[model samples]
Target: MFIDVVPNRGSPPAVLLRESYRDENGRTQKRTLANLSKLPGDVIEMLKALLNGGALIGTAPKDLAIERSLPHGHVAAVLGTIRKISLDRLILSTAKDAASRRFCDLVVAMMVDRLITPRSKLGFVRAVDEETAATSLGNLLRLGKVKDHEPYEALDWLLERQERIENGLARRHLKDGILVLYDVSSSYFEGHCCPLAQFGHSRDHRSDRLQIVYGLLCTRDGLPIAIEVFEGNAADPTTLKSQVDKLKARFGIKRVVLIGDRGMITSARIRDDLKTSSLDWITCLRAPQIQALAQGDGPLQLSLFDERDLAEISSPDFPGERLIMCRNRDLAMERARKREALLKATERELARVQANVRRKGSTLRSAAEIGLAVGEVVNAKKVAKHFALDIRDGHFSWSRKIEQIAAEAKLDGIYVIRTSVPKGELSAQNAVQAYKDLSRVERAFRSLKTVDLEIRPIRHWNANRVRAHVFLCMLAYHVEWHLRQRLAPLLFHDTELDRGRAARISPVASTEPSASARSKKAIKRNANGDPVHSFAGLIDHLGTMTRNIMRMPQAKKHPFTLLSKSTPLQDQAFKLLDLDPMRVQ
Candidate 1:
């Protein structure tokens, strides 16, 4: 028997219970069992349940309860991807001991939290207990009901296997002859107890606070391979030698080209360390070096830019090395605009000082004080070279050094990259491209510091914990890189093809309606007619696919979990990642 709704014109639909039977001649005949609308609500529901193959003895309305509702969809998706990569297995294989496996799970859990909702290590236990109920991580890793100290202890265990874990990652994602981008960044500390924490150049602009320096090594595409932490006082150039040794000795990478910013590795160090070790490198020149290249009769003079934006030349100062000089018109324009703004600001500040000197009733300041005031104005603008300041008779006057300004302006938007890779092996254009890829390491640092993983405010005082914390954040970044690559169609990723030379592609302007109009009209497609969403929006979309727990009354039956139906877009995302959305089951 089935309950069928009968349509009636200009009236509410009629609900009918219909049953079918075969007559003696094998012809079908139907009869009305009952009118469901006329029956009691409970009776009608029971009949509906029986017809739909539901349990007849379901809990009564008053006895039903919701055990808990969790935000399980996003966590499940991340964990599914994590398992597909066999990250947990790779980590566990380092040590077969039970404690090691548990610690591995703890690390994985921390990484997931880092990606989803970052919090302090002490707060992670509560986050997992509340937010990750649908993931099997707790059961698989045996991290149920974590103690506050377990995460720290697990970090200690994980730190012991850092080399092994890094080796595994290198084997998986790295290969010989790949361009590896490296850079260093410092994270400030909340308290200075760690031996590695000391006063250094704080990249986060927290110079007043102590910091710890860490270097990240990643592929040209920004997939992090290894991370190394050092004392806060370690110099950027000083860290390169150890990393080169690790690449050669530990990872066995023989033919890789290391790309770094000029601040990280000087020309001298490249000559001394990389040349002797037979390792190739690509790095840009400092401003003074670029100026020297622009000196009289040099190959990198300003006249070279008139013919082309890039040129390959050999310099006598750097024998047997190729220098790729590039000048960007847009960069030049930007620099010119910035210098004008700074000059104006400095003029206004100097005018204020000059007014004080000319005022009749002003305090009688000494010549030294007036000189100091003039110095402060020029220094603050950082354009002292372009200005000539005069202090005489407790008065000040200044004028623009037109020749100096013109000379400095001649070098705007110009940069030179020095590389040892032979022209036949790597062309000058590719060398420029490779040196520019140092921005990928910069991107990684941005993600680590401000974006997904906030690897700052180093609360861990112990050296081991600091290292482990950085390692955990890097691991999380590895996962994030894969996700972003798969989700590139929805993100503003660098998708231009390399055609053996550099090509600048302007972003295609969206012709879609304004955001306000789109919101009112419920528009979700981009100008390309593809679905448009920010990374966070996509995550929130997938998060709609949740796990629901339904339970009977207290002291009755145990609760059962059911997954919410996935939308087409959510299913597509899972398919792209090759993940099973229902893997939690």
Candidate 2:
């Protein structure tokens, strides 16, 4: 006889109990459990994650009590509107694959936290266990749907919301008009068998590894607006045309101009892309072959040119070839300072060597590298020398070093620029300034490298998910970059200082790198011997908004009615997000 299993709309198929089973010919009876029901949420969560794209076999899961490893443990809360909700609940809404979703969430959080952590403290393995990680990440994997690191889901998601985002941008954003810098770069990862991971030229010279294509779009303000994935090993010049064409078709862009490096300015490609839309482009020119007419400043000569000036020159192949030259007093001072520093450095070396020879009681010597004793010791003096270096043969060393320093200082106060811009529209000086803005792209790359994203050693085994991961990073980049621009006025830029330096230096001092510029490394080796700044320190300080967990006091207020104290950053982030901190719901 058969009995009805549980009858419920959402209940899983019931496990069947066989009362008795008899063979047709012989007299035999058997009983067994049949038709097992849906796998438990926790177990299913695991299975789904593995299928989606979590690397569990190679990794060890977190040490969980073997008894109840089902529900994963602990998700750190973020700022603004989404903090109070449990990690699982917040993630529960749309995970198609339970396992992948959990895994994705953890990884995303880890990525963010890493960005805000000091690089010196960064390591490959920060998570406790592989299995535990698998669980948290499963949720993201599930929603992603297409297997480990698929971009299809992300692409579909973006396409679905295209109308809304475009409308919002058209109406409210792009106030400064859209200056789109379109380019393609590739990210490399170790997994070669991955269909997505194909051979490509590595920007970091890691062609030894497999790579995939990535497209980036940025605002003139250095904000990343969108990221797309192309086939691995795609050409940069060709990647340019497609992205430019696609953006025009999909978005409501007003006054869009394409800015690209010299590599992308192909005449044939330009004609093809222009035929598709009426977009303007600005590109750097390789020096054009000079004409005797241009040589003598014949008619049609560039109008705005000076010792420090910008002048536009007309070119048949391109338009808006405005040449500009500009002088920044600060840059000029830096030039002088650097030359003086070099002289001082050479002079110091000469003195040190002279002292060393005297202490050793050795004869006069030549230049350290040149091996030429290019000076004469016309005078001799002995100064008390306690250190390892000695004072001797003063004159012979002095004359040659002085000559060398003078030669070095003589070549100062000069630089130049050339452009194809029309003579009347722009000057050589202004054109040079515009070209200098190309540094913005470098700043953008630094963010992609250290601050908001990590695009190297791609580990995704699947084709689509790799793309999706990159796309999401671009999204985060957009958010954080815009936040930086907004926060700049509030926090001033310190040319030479970072958070650590800020603690020692005045907060308002104009010589340090502040939180806004923390995304990029501002200091290079300068002869001044100033302290180096750290991005890691700035991120740790700024991102760490302090909070105190308190027990509600015994009072008329209900336990559920308790409130927490306000944090300055929390309040600021809340206001920026347009969230109500008091009413979390």
Per-residue lDDT of model 1, residues 1-585, tens digit only: 888779978987778999989999999998897777677768877778889887654457766565665555667667777787887777788477877777778888888778777789877877665345444335434467788898999888778888988888889877898888999989999896789999988888888999999999998888898999999999999999988998898999888899999997797788778988888889888999988878788787777777578877888899988888888877888999999999999999999999998888777367888888888888997988888888876677889998878888999888888888888988776787778767688888988888778998889988999999999899888888878878655544433333212334211111233343353235555444457576667766777776666776654667776667777777777777877766652
Choose the strongest candidate by lDDT: 1
lDDT of 2: 0.45
lDDT of each: 0.79, 0.45
Where model 2 places Cα greater than 4 Å from the true spot, the runs are: 1-172, 175-177, 288-308, 316-435, 489-539, 542-585
CA RMSD (A), model 1: 6.4
For residues 161-262, what per-residue lDDT tens digits would candidate 2 score against the true structure? 434443343334443235566666776777767776777777767768878877676666565656667767777777776666555765656446666766
Q: What is the lDDT, from 0 to 100, of the residue 518 in candidate 1? A: 50
Q: Highest TM-score, which number?
A: 1
Error of 1 at 137 (Å): 5.7
Cα lDDT over the full model 1: 0.79
Model 1 scores worst on lDDT over the 10 consecutive residues at 505-514
